[model samples]
Target: MFNKKYTIVKNEEVIPGHRLMCLNAPEIASRAAPGQFLHLRCGDGQDPILRRPLSIHFADRGRVYILYRIAGRGTSRLALMARGDIVDVMGPLGRGFTLPAPGERVAVVGGGIGAAPLFFLLKKIGKIYGKKKDMVRVFLGASTLAMVPGAAQIRKMGFPLDIAADDGSGDFKGTVVDMFRKEAKNLALDRVYACGPPPMIRALAGAVGPDPAVEVSVEERMGCGVGACLSCACKVRAGEGEGFGYARVCTDGPVFDLRKLVL
Candidate 1:
């Protein structure tokens, strides 16, 4: 919930469609948890209108990293930002993933750009549950191997990784959901955390059906990263209501219990 102005120390392209930006924001990093995001304002003035929300990829002692894809004009402008640039940032916002407890077997599933949050999640999970390290498993999926961070690095962190791609280009040539199903079929899991495109998340929901431990990250276009504008409403499974209801993806959650959400 912190509103901190950060100066960009480094902004570099890490992959073909994505850029990694490091910011000097000690406060946000200090309080940030895995799966959280930041709302970044492009310019000093309001010309761009709304702030773009970027996933918090990694954070260290006095800095935070955001990984984003150049999907539109706003993100394109953000990619062009130079080093030493100052941007208005609000967050470490939204609810983050629940850290695993002792001996809790956890599974992390991510797809496409969704791998952003899972990076931090992996680090945090390892930090908290390292004593029971053997209980955790991570699966990442993308169109190709280049889209995800190196698997060796993630495995070095002590979590076993299962990778999949769409075109038979990698280990499992199918959707990330396929990886989830394959892993779930082979292992005993206590909880599952997922982030990806809508179709991926929806498919994951089906794959994780009736599992109370499955949590998902919701991605949607937003006019306001904050909930005040109600511009990022998404259809969600209404608990007691007749059918689906609109929920604010920004505030209510970017992370939700998979069984509770209609997706």
Candidate 2:
């Protein structure tokens, strides 16, 4: 994990209240994996003392992408940044999703801003496994089509997509988990991955049962991005008799098996 200042290559509002920022951080980009995140200092001073954590939306050879919602003070500061601005960031940290073998069928489920990190995963999947529509399927959920990040990009990439909206503004009129429950078997999904709200993750875990084939990337508030603060601890099922244990989301994981997580 490297702590460095990266120049913003592109920082533009993609949809209302959500912005996509690109950074010229070759070191962090090249080493970053799917489901990893960056801890960012939104502005020059420490008005916001704790750095905000944003997932790696997508990364290429020498550039990194961040898709974030302007939800609070830190994010509001982030949105104000322009193309030439430099931001302090630390990352590509935490455990990431395990890539599937080329022959295995893959599925990705995302909700609202949680859909951002999955973009890098899909891009990597396309590169490593080849972008055959049948090889991969995408399900995105949001309040409306406008709120779902990366939907157009996913469509442009040609992955078979199924989107759901709370207000019936997207393809489906129900929750994403409900849609997945109805379609997962038909798709013959070999492995499933997801990122979303806690309730959504809990529902997904309940539906999939305790299985290694399903993994998820969790979001938690962090004080120290490097695991020193113990601020991002989460529960996980320990073993057959051990009950549960706490794991640091920053260092131990942002990614874990849905079955193993105590939701």
Runs in model 2 deviating more than 4 A are 209-212
> lDDT of candidate 1?
0.83
Q: lDDT per model, in order?
A: 0.83, 0.88
lDDT of 1 at 126: 82
Off by over 4 Å in 1: 240-242
TM accuracy, model 1: 0.94
Worst 10 residues of 2 by lDDT: 203-212
Error of 2 at 123 (Å): 0.6
Clash pairs, model 2 backbone: none
Candidate 1 lDDT over 141-221, as tens digits, reads: 988878886467788887878789887776788988987887787666778888999899878877864543988889877
The lDDT leader among the candidates is: 2
What would the per-residue lDDT of candidate 2 be over residues 208-232, giving only the tens digit for each residue?
6433299899888998989899999
